[model samples]
Target: MFWATGWKPIVLAAAMLLASASSALAEEGVPTPGDLLAERLDERLGEQEVALQAFYAARDGRPAWQETATVAALANALRTLDADGLTPQDYRPDTLVAAHRQALAEQSSPAARARFDVQTSQTLLTALRHLQRGKVDPYRIDPGWEVPIEAPPLDLAAISQAVDARRFEQAFASARPSSASYERLRASLARYRHIARQGGWPMMPPRSQSLRPGELHDDVLLLRERLAILGELEVMAAGVSAGVEPQATEPRRYDERLVAAVERFQQRHLLEVDGIVGPRTRAALNVPVVTRIDQIRVNLERARWLLHGLPDSFVLVDIAGYRIRYFRPDGDVWRSRIVVGRPYRRTPSLRSSISHLTINPTWTVPPTILREDVLPRVRRNLGYLWQQDLMVLSPSGRRLDPRDVDWWRPGNVILRQRAGPRNALGRVVLRFPNDHLVYLHDTPAQALFAREQRAFSSGCIRVQGVLELAQHLFDDTGTEAEVSTLVAAGRTRNVHLERPVPVILHYWTVHPDEEGRLVFRPDVYQRDAALLEALDASPTR
Candidate 1:
């Protein structure tokens, strides 16, 4: 709104003239026009007053938007903010363009020019800040978010200098997260936006029976069209080539080629590769293109939150996607499936370094798991303790018989499982320091890893192929033989790493796959709604 209007030319000119003359006419030093304009800018910058004042003072109170090329560069940058999943309207690009035009008009006044300068600077600074850190502070919305997003302090003086040198484009590029993942998501956003502009893909009608290969149905036409729109299907030009009849071109028939395309679609969506049009696959297909666009946008903001300042090599736990990746410095990446916490006991997002690994680890049942999970089953049957190979211990480290204790009030006593084949933490535990006390470990319940949506753990992560991951973390420190011996002997041991590897336990419902295509996962913890609400709200200064 500040850049929407201009002051009357005659009155503003007369005030400027009087203010300039007052410098010569002052008995008690009157403020000049530039000083008055600076005062106006300070008043407009509420909390940012100090930084902005320093910015202008370094330039001797001169306007930063004097150059037409600089202004045009900034305007162009603001217009393309949508590529970064930012709403251009939030930065007032239309108002900026209009005000810039008015400032360059024949009857423009100094007041109008000063307003344009202050408002344009504020808009650019806000956009840059959002691009650097994020529009929403993740902690404000989700208190359990523990990843440190310490925004780098803004050096307004340097920014002012860059603008003066007409290096606004370079400054903006430097402000954004420079990760390949971010760039891929931006490209995916553009593709999805283009899909939406073309009226999106068609939705198929509901059917009772599952559609398999060699089936003929009217809804197959919609399915073919939908898959083709998403580039998952290659529509054959109306001619047979190999192992095909002329009727294979019929849209109503679900032939072998269609089955292959369906498998590809399933793979992209992380669904079963059976190629049958079942309920889950159908639901995935019917998701509107606009909704997919928002999914990419939401993940773009997420990428902004944590993609910067990464170490050369670290482990990334993609909670929602049920996978973890180990990035090596030599551009090699190792990945495996994982089982994260369930919805009710949602795993927290955090950053910490893996300090060491515990081999043949025993499970000291956490308090919450003891109360809600173990005690209930033990109360139903006292033999549950023996079945689980758990030992009951007193507060003073003395072993107690389960039959001698009261199941109704097992106060202060600890339940620890012996290190064995049936132990909950199978053979290894990757420990990290955090208030939540969760870690990555091997699980005997490896069947859960086969699930498409693996959220079965209490809070800690159960990793598949954990031994391979531990060996990689060791980084050829010659401890592989010792680890194997200790694990085979069933002896408890802690193996400190040669150097601690950083680990980030994060949640993301959309991310790029190995091929750089976007993979949309389910919002298992229902976090997207709150974040989407915060992002859609009017931005703050």
Candidate 2:
């Protein structure tokens, strides 16, 4: 019905209508493109809260980025965005609610269970309680290895530095206390010193200075308490014989024997071998019984957040102490020492399921590995690949005549290694698809397990006991007997998997044990500072 001139008017009118619609959307809280992107990030972050909360609780006895703040920020974003109209595609409030209810059902006692439910609900509503200002957890490990004490002349900087190290010496040096208060503190120190005289501190080697700023908040407190408690533990350990067993020998153990036992306990707890108890060890020993109870509560919260909604089975890699643990549906089933990636090439945090396992696996070297390690060796000596039993393949699938490509040119080339005894992947590979290009595999370098410190891999975990692990995974698949037979033969057999387990590569440097005693592990990867800042600045729920 319109001519060419009439069409121009129609176009203008359409343009106006579109602009009006856009304006209306803006007024209704539909964010701009930039804001929309932020919203998307917030959405994904919201989903990550469960795992994040678990990590936080494990590391600091509370969520690093408080759940309360997160939830509040999310709510604000939702309000600003008018998310009701947009609607979340993959998220469901009812699903979270159902999960909450299921967790509540799992608690054994009604009162205890109610408390658990309250905590969970708190996490949901408030975000989380992150950093409590000025209230440092006494259980944390010392960030600085040693506190620098100021002597005759007061060095304020030196005193402050020492105070930061969790050393009481600095406290005394910095004391501007009233005479009465000073006297009281002096008396406490004297009492501590008296205990130190009778019982030596749990002697521990000088801890490395590489620990991250905030990863060990709870651990620092625990360490302090452990130091306090060491005197007691020493007394207990020196004299405390193993409790009488109905099926066993002695009715009671003597005090000297108990001291010996305490020494053994010190060794097991990673404390120094000094037979004497000092202030540090004494403090650790004097940990109040109530603190252990608190540890249990914190660990419970962690389990609820981390393991509550998880799949039936997965691989858990504890990065701090460099250990790998496997969990089956039944219970705490299996564990092994693993050589994780080095600090420089850190293993990542991710969730993926192992889809397959390859026996006598051919190693198709990842591009990064080739560039960083293999290529340099190849350049230095052409025989490097042949020595390692590796083969160079062209894109066309032919054996790359190494002569064809200019050896000196930076280029693209596929490198594969034939499976044999010398293969880097050793006898097996657990395949899990992930962005980190990581997997669990056997390593030819098995001797590294003998060292106390084991952070030496490129990124993949080099498991110490792959043979046993393989047997365990293949038990239900009926391949365990066959695998064992193959191992006996020692010639290597390539076997594909029938079913694969899930692998969760995570980074947690602190955790509590069954006895509710908080434990410390080396923070092999430094990743706490940025996280701490993020935690501190995050909005409160």
Query: All models: lDDT?
Result: 0.83, 0.50
RMSD of each: 5.8, 23.2
Residue lDDT tens for model 1, 313-415: 8899999999999997677999999999999999899999999999999898999999999999999998899999999999897999999899899999999
Please give the range of 10 consecutive residues that has the lowest summed lDDT in model 2.
130-139
- Tens-digit lDDT track for model 2 on 389-501? 87878777678777676766746678888877788888877778776778888999988877655788888888989878777777744444555566455554556556667
Predicted structure with the largest TM-score when compared to the true one: 1
Clashes within 3 Å, all models in order: 0, 59
Count backbone clashes in candidate 1. Answer: 0
Q: lDDT winner among the candidates? A: 1
Error of 1 at 23 (Å): 14
Model 2 residue 123 distance off true place after TM-score fit, in angstroms: 10
Please give the TM-score that candidate 2 achieves against the real structure. 0.50
